[model samples]
Target: MNKRSPLDRHKQIRARLARRLFVVRGWLVLETVWRAAWPVGAMIGAYFALALLGIWEQAPAFVHLAVFGLVLLGGAGILWHRLRRAIWPGDADARRRLEESGGARHRPIDAVFDAPAMAAGASVLWRRHRDHMAETAQDLPVKAPRLSLVYEDPRALRAIVLLALFIGALYAGPDAGRRLFQALQPPFGDAPRTVVLDAWLTPPDYTGKSPIVLHGPITANKAHDEAAAPLSAPVGSMLVVRLNGGRQAPVLLAGEDDIPFDTVGTVDHRLEFALSDPDLSVLEIRQGGRSRALWPLALSPINRRASALSEPPLKVVGKPCG
Candidate 1:
């Protein structure tokens, strides 16, 4: 045999390496497809489940169905081609002969040896490729797509919903407003408003008796006379008024002896009666027994004035809140 140059030996090594690399690349592509395809298949399965469960409104069900169909068809076609070669030795031979000029060039045992050797050489290349890929991945940075104000945030959606509600209410106007208010019931039945306090009011400077005053317009008919004595604290009364000023005031009526109130700890705003007389007025009040000076005792009708003029301007109400 003729002496071979070092450069020729190197070229031979490179040619063998290139052939092995081609095989390795085919395997890598196959593995990559297999790995990627499963997740897509899983995603498709999940989307199909969501569609069946009736939760596909968020993302169109048909899109997922179509993707699944296309991927299945593509994968099936690729698998069928690979299986055709694997299944029939004659088919593989014919294809190999057609590609390589009419002769069956290699022996079966030669292929077995070459296959293992190619795999071993490819393993080295695969390790290098993996290292290269890791280095490449380190060099790159991941980035997310930018979204404008209304596209991606829940707050924006909430704002839109609120705006829609306000517009709807504005269109429906007063009747809707009244219905909305009427629909809401107070925490307690319309009980006469009463407040509980930690202490009672101070006695007037001159008189030793603790004083209490009733404010608000007194109805001419419901003057709260002695005949209507022992007035029951009716339901639906709200403790609308509060008194923090004036330490001392005139007590409405004085009992002969030191009453349960005087003997007990400071009496908060509550019903009181003289020990001698059981028949007495039961006035509802704030913590210090002060009345709401703002509104009258009874609501007045606005027959003389228009409804719009009688009431304040309507306002948009938000989602039902307590």
Candidate 2:
């Protein structure tokens, strides 16, 4: 029986590395998609829910979210390709070490990674390396390594754990979760450095209202001294402004006789203010006198749509005076 040469053994190792490289790269992409896809989906779902719940139906907001999701995924693909190529399987030195774990006892696979399809014109140095491989071949009966150097990696369990939690929270109360999702968004302007505000604008149950949250409502660190959206309620109607996650002192604020905001709590302020007159009001969040945020309030007549026109056709009593 003819003995197969060391070249054959080296070739075999290279082939194995190539195959293993594919495995590693595929796993990386799978892991990245696994981690990125769901959160993106959750965010999009939450945004849709908020829109349906009458939070804000501006198309641009959803457009920005879609662009962001595509960008994240596109960049992930580019990074995955780059990372895969970083491992040069063609390097004979690397291949030898790879097989070394499989029982290539000596550094016999030195040029395994660098060797060309066939070693070109033989120099003394080249011949010496070749001769070493040839001699080493005698020891390798089948050149099959005892164990594969590469191990398979799967999706991260930690990410999966967090994903489960996020999903649970999302289902438990989508409206409540909407606030957190909002904060995760990129701030529009130069937002505050470290803090986040999760505010919920809950409509009064009498108004058949459910809770709607605005996460990262104040994304900009230095936000305008005004509310993002106007809070409108008819006279005698109630509005609940629940603020969470702020490093500021809270005070039961009264805005100059403009229907006092009888709020609750200090650190995390939950301002439950009632409407009386058809006047404007504001809810300001001030902490350390540095961070300040405002929420506008609009009061409507007790019967917003109720009018004399609805009571009875207008009376032409003016003619009697004439």
Every model's TM-score: 0.20, 0.33
Worst 10 residues of 2 by lDDT: 144-153
How good is model 1 by TM-score? 0.20
lDDT of 2 by residue, 185-210 (tens): 63343333233454555543445556
Residue 172 in candidate 1, Cα distance off native in Å:
23
Task: Give the per-residue lDDT digits (tens) of candidate 1, residues 1-322.
Answer: 9999644654454455345434444544444444334434444444333333223222333543454466567657655555444422243432232223323233321232232435545876744444443332222221221123343243554454445556545543433333233222111322222222322222222233344333333221234332342322212222222322111221223223322122121111223432223332233322124332222222122233443464577898889878
Which portions of model 1 miss their true places by more than 4 Å? Answer: 1-118, 138-157, 160-200, 207-281, 285-322
> What lDDT does model 2 reach?
0.47
Question: Candidate 2: lDDT of 242?
Answer: 50
Error of 2 at 13 (Å): 7.5
Each model's lDDT: 0.34, 0.47
Q: How far is candidate 1 from the true structure (C-alpha RMSD, Å)?
A: 25.3
- What range of 10 consecutive residues in model 1 has the weakest lDDT sum? 260-269
List the candidate 2 regions with Cα displacement exceeding 4 Å: 1-99, 105-191, 194-232, 250-252, 256-269, 276-280, 295-322
